[model samples]
Target: MRRLLPRNSLRSRLLGDLWKPLFCLLLLGAVAVFFLARHIGSSVYDRWLYDSAMTLAEQVRVEDGKAVLDLPKQAVEMFEWDQVDRIFSDVRSRRYGLIFRNSDLPPPPEELQPGQSRIFPHWVKGHAARVVAVAVPNPADPADVLVIQVAETMLKRNTLATDILVLVVPVLVVLALLVGIVVWRAVATGVRAVDQVVERLDSYGPDRLLPVGEITNAPAEVRPLLNAINQLIRRLSDLQDTQRRFIANAAHQLRTPLATLQVQTERALREPDAARHGQALSRVLKAVTRSRHLAHQLLMLARSEQSGEKALQMQEVDLAVLARDELERWIDSALQQHVDIGYDGPESGVEVYGEPVLLRELIGNLVDNAIRYGSVRDDGRRGGAVTLRLQVQPIMLVVEDDGPGIPPSERTLVLERFYRRRGAGGQGCGLGLSIAREIAQRHGARLVITDPPQGMGARVEIRFAR
Candidate 1:
């Protein structure tokens, strides 16, 4: 179920998390203050009641072993007089039932002793009162003791309690307000810092893909997010630089073929002799074919670059079967160039996981490169042999030719786009080996260029991990 009130903002979540415990703390503090005020009010009034009971005790005396009051009626009336509370008093002896009394009050305990006092709440004439009870020894008879109790109505205590609440509650509320303000300012400052980072991102364009610099006064908690954003910007900037260079190189490579095609078309259209026109047309067809192959290779290279984002359409492909089929397809083209082509592996059962179309492209590029470059010798002879060898144990594909082998120093260089060897003898652009290497990598295989073990020729091997 969805939340009734979802906390969507960082500021609100932070404040909510912090203020829950803060609110509880304030509530407890208020409760403590209320009880403290009540205690203070009670303590102040209880002292007055105790003193009154003690004064009444002093006025008592023992006459002929009987406890009596030597106080006058006016004195009693004056002692009990108050503006806010009604006062009540009683004097009694253990030996005698009662000695003197003013009004009905709750009596002290039966086991009362001299010089001890207790204060508590009681009802005086159906009104709430606070009572203080004291006991005194009779002077004439040490065995006899008198108990005295004094109580007053609750008016003065209630007024003191109300005054205490009035004085304290506002101070507590102001303190809570100050704390809330501080918390709100802190949350707002942090949120503003994050908003500033967002604003900086919004201001960026494709031409200005710069990193977000460190923000001043940003909290330490935000440092990791800034670092991640800067890293992403750096990657995007690097990718843009690579794309620009790729476009420039691709355009440069296609220019010669297009110019040749244009010239051949113009010549074919202008020639008067049928034979010369037919020859010009053939050259134009060859130029168009070369241009088409170059464009297809460039598209393949772009696809390889973008294929990282997609899941491979993987299937169990027989490596030996794939190589034999590719070799068969290229044999006619090889014979036309006077280069013998053969396969040296099992007809089937050498299986690996890869996309079939991409695998075919990989093998085609390798075989095409072998036919174009491996058929020519240093002396320009056009008869040589190319072999496709596959190993089932380690799952490898090796394409080797009996021609001038690439030098060790130039092996890695040839894998880079458009990196032809210094004395290379082929009409092929340098994307063949690089595209083969890209496809090999995507299939969890490694492509390496080396010389044949028993002959001096270029040998390219793709080793798939078992």
Candidate 2:
């Protein structure tokens, strides 16, 4: 039902918001002009009425011991003559009740003294009239005075007011129309600018994702939105590049192990002698195990790379216990490599807040990297020592080994995915240190690589904030 209604655009809302108040202001101005015109017209006509009353006062006199008007019937008719109005006159004295009158005009409510005059409005026979009253001294008796009043209907005043309104109203309407057109055009131009911005956005594709160019003529209000959109575009571009690199590297790392496994399996099947057949099978099993371990590490690296807040299941983890358990699991591998590995931490638990599974992965990767790369000598013999050490009070964990230590300049590079040292011996895919670093970051811990305290060995330390 709501969809059936016309949608309001920016232009319509802007015009509506501007026009409603303008229309009311114009209407109020017209009404004020009309009343002002009426008032001015009344003032001009009132002076004429007062002059007519003074002329009547000239004809008043004392005759036969009484106040009388000496105006003849012809003069009386001439005094009352008007083209578009009816006129009324009344002459009265305080000593006498009534002196002379042309029509039945009511006397004024207020008293009038000699040499005084007054003009006021009154209603006459259901029509509006202007009344002017004047007082004059009687010629026969100076003590007594005569009051003469003249009144005329408001026909001329009404005509003048109507003519003024007719002249002014059309001009006001034309001015209002001109203002509306200007406002409408201004609003449309602003909306068109916004439309251009939207069109620019729609032109973008995945491969063509470039930041928007700056528009010199754009409104000030739109600049902040453009800046935010540009920031988002940059972030998306970086993510896209990272994804491309990860896919390429993963494929390259898997190809070598997969090819080895296939070759060993074929060689095992082609062996005729029973003893040689068992030896080929053993190599085949070793290849399969190495490939499986690579695949698992790749999965672990991917899991550690995720940065979503909800993916981490955090709890209080005992670092000492976790290290001891993981060390026990790697005992057989260390023995096979002819390397001595052990844990050196408190017997009791030292708890920290983290995800237990990720923490175990972090510790396992550190141990695995040490055992793989550190179990070698200059003579090509596979024998060395790796130790997992823990401390409290600004908690720290250290994995140290007695082997050729990493170069100071390449310490940072080793933390990158698939970055291996030159001439390093092992079946390592070079993801162990990278996975350890990622998990350490997720747990809000700092991982640093430096020389161990005793002398010639690599020391990797994790410092927890708590």
Candidate 3:
């Protein structure tokens, strides 16, 4: 069942709630003022009534020791000015008797005592009155009593109070509304700086890392966030500049050897004698091949450095299968060189996620590097075979050549780009291990160089992350 409620309810929106409390306070203030004015006016009027009563008492004479009044007409006329009604009574022999009375309404209850006052709504006779009555000793005899009662109709007091409220309430309300509007405008203006900052950020891009312009009227709270963003932009801009310079320098340095090899190949093609031409052409082709391999490796290294971490399309692939396929492709080349190439892995799949092209390049480089470097030995005559192994359970790719192994002291140096070992005779630009290391890093894997288990040759292992 729905419950009944008062006519005035307080539940409302923010502004509505605010205004109600203020309006209530204003209304209470207005009521207080109305009552205060009435009290002061009534006090003045009561003094006048008492004075009239005193004057009438003064006029009393003890003719036969009884009270007789010689009340003046002017004193009665004074009550009419304030619309005040009066009632006069004479007391003799301790009994009350009505003397002269003038009122626009019926008198109050007879139980009313002199010098006592009461205020109530008087709906009878179509009007309300505030009444006061007083009794005093007859001044002429002190044995007779004279009472004076005064009442003012409340209609005039109510009209005056209504007029005051009509004038004051609108003024207060208008003042409150103006205050609210000013506060809202101030708040909006304060937050405008944050909007400008957001607009600047919306237009920003990777290339444009410039600091956002300072907002002139930004709020204190948002300034720190803006400063941090500006600092981040500056740091990224510095890093990008460094990477661009590195790519440029690496490209310039690698192009020189490539051009030299191209010129040598053209010179060798122009030789006249068939035998000499064939030998020179073969040498030129070997140089050209080495140059081409170096150029490709350099390009791959540059891509790895410049592309950040997103260059590879990673997916779950079986490294064991990849090793088998790579070995098949290189088997004919190994046969021509009178070398043995083989792969070893379990039948089950060894799954790993990485860019397939880069992973192929990585494994191919390791095997090619081992074969090329391990083909010649201290005793010469191609000592032993090369083996490509894919260990599935741990996901490791191992390339080992049974040629004279690398010295333990030079293992780390061999992985640096273009750093060929002193006694290692091969037509390589020394980028195989470097390129392999880069591809391994891209896949969150590691390339480690160590002596093979039999201690005959170097073993290169690419270990994938678990």
Candidate 4:
């Protein structure tokens, strides 16, 4: 039902918004003009009525204490000169009333003072009229007398009003149209910058995700929105770069193991001696193990890349408990590799807010990496000690191995996915530190590699903000 409602377009709405108020002003002007025209036409023609009444009064005289008017034929004809109007005149004494008249014109609506002429409006003989009365003093007559009353038809006044209307109405209409046009244009001009911004944004694509050609013409109200969009584009570009790197790294890691497996399988198929066959089989198994570990790391990295808040369990779990459980899984392997791994912490739990499974992976990766790279050199000689310590003073987990420490330059690079040191061994696919760092980040901790206080080897410290 709501979809049926008409949507307002900005241009039309702008023009209409401006026009409504101006149209109301125009209507007010029209009403004022109508009244003005009526008043002006009545005022200009009222003088003619006064003149005719004065002419009749001049011929009036007092005879035997009664007023007599020696009104001539040509003199009376002067009042009747208008071709479109009928005129009537009456002269009466205030004391001795009803001296002379053309018709039974009534007395003025209100009394008149001496030398003052009053105009009244009425209907006469079923026609509209304008009435004027003048009070003039007659010294020769004994009566306190009034001079003349004249009533004229409305034809001349109405014609004058119509003429004024016809002349002025066209000009007013044209002016109103001009004003409306100016208002519409002004409204359009005010929002032109918004239109230009929209057009520039419409033409944009990912390849053009920069400044959008600098919308200098856009309105100040939209500048903040543009800035926010630019920031988002920059973030998206970084994400794209990271994704490309991840894909390339995954492909390169998998390709090496698969190629090794292929060659070993071919060698096993061609071998006939039982001892050589077992050697080929063992090598193939090792390649399969490496490939399987690489695939697991890739899957874990992908899962960790999801929205951390959603993927993480909010319940508090003990970080030190997870470390112990994961350390137990690696102890046998560490002992087999002649690496002495020990855990030092409180006998109980060290509580924290995080997903236990991911934290286990983080601890497992750290321990496994220590065993693989820490103690034994390639010639089977042991020289290093692996220690896992959980400190409570500001809540930190520390994993230290006594081996040749990572060089200062490569410490940072080694944490990136699939980035390995120059002589790094086959025990890792190089994703362990990267995965551990990602989990630490999800748990709002910083993973930093620093020199162990014991002089040699790398210390991977996961520090929690208290």
Candidate 5:
């Protein structure tokens, strides 16, 4: 069963994570504002109601110890036409008395006592009414009871609350949307700097190490990352400059000696003594051959160190045939040293793709190096047998010898340029294996050295990629 993974849309997820919290906070704030407005509005209305009630109660008088209200016309109008009703009652009798009230208004249920107030639910002519009852002492006559009541319809109060909500909700929504847009833009602006840096780095290669010129208006927090990127560009440019200088110097130094040896060899052939002339000719030829080999090795090393993808002119070549051809070419030298050289593999061709000339050089160098350093034995033999075998399925080439194998600790060291082993007999430069390794790397192959089977000799294996 496959489990579902979260979808990969960034904007959707960002909104999903942000909108809930933001909406909740906005809703809480709106509710708080609504309740606060309602409380303040109700308190102001109650104060107006109390003032009107007190002023009307002050105009009352007592006739023979009975209370009578002398409410002014302005005081009566102060209740407002929208108010539900008004009433006066006797506080001692606990009964309603002179009620100069509108027929559309509901009366209070009971009279109010001295210093007492009550709110009553009233229905007046198809409208809701809120009635307040307050008690007052008769000022002119003692032992007289009076009560005043005020009522107002709730239509205006409901309209005001609704108006406040209508005005407030839209403003809150607009503010929330504006805040969301600002946050998204700010985040995008900040992250775009990193995007530009990545694009510049992606376009870079060994040939181009220039820093990105565009600067971001990022916050101070991200300054370190931009600084580090600039530092890396500087370091890479320095390394590339150093590598170019080294290659140039090596080519110049090696070419001079080669040119001098070629000139000297041509001049030395003019000797007249027959025997001496032959010996000198042989020495000159050997020197010329050594110089040519050195030049070839140096060129191969320089090409391998170049930083880019090389164009490999690959073709299918037979490994067994190539190995046999190289061995036959070196047959005379093997016979002189009394070394038995042989190639062992399938008679049919084993095909591989690479530069055939480079492959031949790689195989030839391994075989030659084995014969030179692999000749000494405990039985006092001048040369030993060298065998080259190709394993077709694994795409491997193995060269083995009865000569003393390199020690385990020095196996890696021998592959370095000009690194010669102790007590080894060799006249040529120690670049044969190094050149072979370089060519193997270019062909996407690995060269490994280890003791051969039966612990008798060294085995060199070149394994090619499939």
Candidate 6:
């Protein structure tokens, strides 16, 4: 029943909802009213029948050893007082036959012998009637009895029913209608708050991200929806801020390399000596490589952010095998930096669900950043070991580098693109940690940076919930 109603209009759905119960009450009330009226009418008419019979019995007297009658025509005519009703009377004596009766009146089923009388309903000249029969003692002879019966048509009973229903039905109907009106008005008033909310949302735009004023007065039933809508607006505002920051950072990082490339090309054109020209060309090539790396990192960041919207194309793969594979790709770079980097885990069977290529890129970014910024020791010595440890306990991955460890204050800051800390000198565009964080989040994993137990290097742990 609830599912059948459309959600758009509350008033139409609930209006006249009271009618169902009212209608059922009316059905039950109809039976009750009918029986009650019939009982009242039958009581009144049955009493009148017995009174007329008793009166007729009074006139049946025995005088001088014989039963005699002195019944007035006026007494009989009074029984037919209603124009719509017909009346009948009969009198019999123990020693005599019928003394008086309407010729068309139907006889009682049993003979009214002396000292026997009863009251019952029987048809009279094709019309329904109530009858009363009684035995009366003779005034002179107590042994002998006179029988008297009287019947009357049911005009007064019919009139009573018509009058009662005409009065009762309207009062109930008016009460039902009034109650329905009151409920309808109350429903419409209560839902006015929701209508105000709809009007506010109808004109909403991206610039208006604040909570709606109308919500404070809204009914409690709709508060959850209002709060949820406000939360959506806040999320959209945060997304807008992130996009602006990303664009500004990308532009700033690209400018320096591009300007350096332009200057180096001009210097190369001005130099006539082949060796110096070759040196200038080399500088220009380095600038181009830096610019290319920055652009690629920007693309990776964009892809990771959108991974939430685009469903992950996943497959089960061995994390140990994937990390080792990426480790091999970075070996040459680690050697160039004199960084002793290696995989320290099993060869296979650390399985997880992920996009293979993206997972590989996530590992490569973390390892590459370690080799670039993590090759120096705290004592300012170069060529230190950076280990990639994949542990099966709790399904975790840890990357530790014996380099100048990140300061506690800058640990979280480094995860933001282009956010570098004090004395953090490197060739990085500050997107390596950011890219790794995004990829890990996409895989339903948590990434935390902490100092290793030895307290001399930074440790990054990626933990996946089981």
Who wins the lDDT comparison? 1
- Name the top TM-score candidate: 1
| Candidate achieving higher lDDT, 2 or 3 | 2
Write down the worst ten-residue block by lDDT for model 5: 84-93
Q: Write the per-residue lDDT of candidate 3 for residues 7-105, one digit (tens) a residue.
A: 332122333555577678777877776776666665665565556545544565656555555546786565355543423333222344554555443
Tens digits of lDDT, candidate 1, 1-466: 1321358878668878877888887778777777787789889889888888888888877678666887877887799889888998888777766788889977688766787888888988899998888988876678888889888898877777778777887887788889888988887777676888889989987587888898988888888988988888887777776677669878998999999999999999999999999999999999988898889888888777655435788999887787887778987889888998888889999889998888888999999998888888888778789888888888899999888888999999999999988777877889999999999999999999988997688999999985
Candidate 5's displacement at residue 422, Å, is 4.2
- Global lDDT of each model? 0.84, 0.83, 0.67, 0.79, 0.70, 0.79
Q: For candidate 5, lDDT tens digit of each residue in 201-281? A: 888775898866647586575677788878777766766765775577566656765676666566567767788777767
TM-score against native, each model: 0.77, 0.73, 0.55, 0.65, 0.44, 0.72
Better candidate number, 3 or 6, judged by lDDT: 6
lDDT of candidate model 1 versus the reference = 0.84
Q: Per-residue CA lDDT of candidate 6, range 1-466, in tens? A: 3422554567666664656777889767766776688779888878888788787776766667777666577865665566777788887666566767764555543566555667787788788887878777766567656777788877777778767877787877787788887887777667777777777877888566555555555778777877787777667766666677678878888889899999999999999999999999999998887888889898888777767556899899799999999999988888987899978889999999988988898888989888877886545556887899999977888889988888888898999878866666556788999999889888998889999889987898889764
Candidate that beats the other on lDDT, 2 or 5, i.e. the better one: 2
| Candidate 5 segments whose C-alpha is farther than 4 A from its true place | 1-282, 303-308, 315-318, 376-382
Candidate 4 local Cα displacement, residue 59, angstroms: 7.9
How far in Å is the alpha carbon of 132 misplaced in model 1?
Answer: 4.3
Candidate 1 has what TM-score? 0.77
Model 3 residue pairs with clashes: none
Q: Provide C-alpha RMSD values for all models, in order.
A: 5.3, 5.4, 11.5, 6.5, 12.7, 5.8
At residue 129, candidate 4 shows an lDDT of 92
Clashes of each: 0, 0, 0, 0, 0, 0
Better of 2 and 4 by TM-score: 2
**Candidate 4: where is the Cα deviation over 4 Å?**
1-77, 80-210, 221-236, 268-289, 292-404, 432-446, 462-466
lDDT of 4 by residue, 11-108 (tens): 67766666788778777777777778878888877887888788778878867866787667887787566789899888887777777888878875
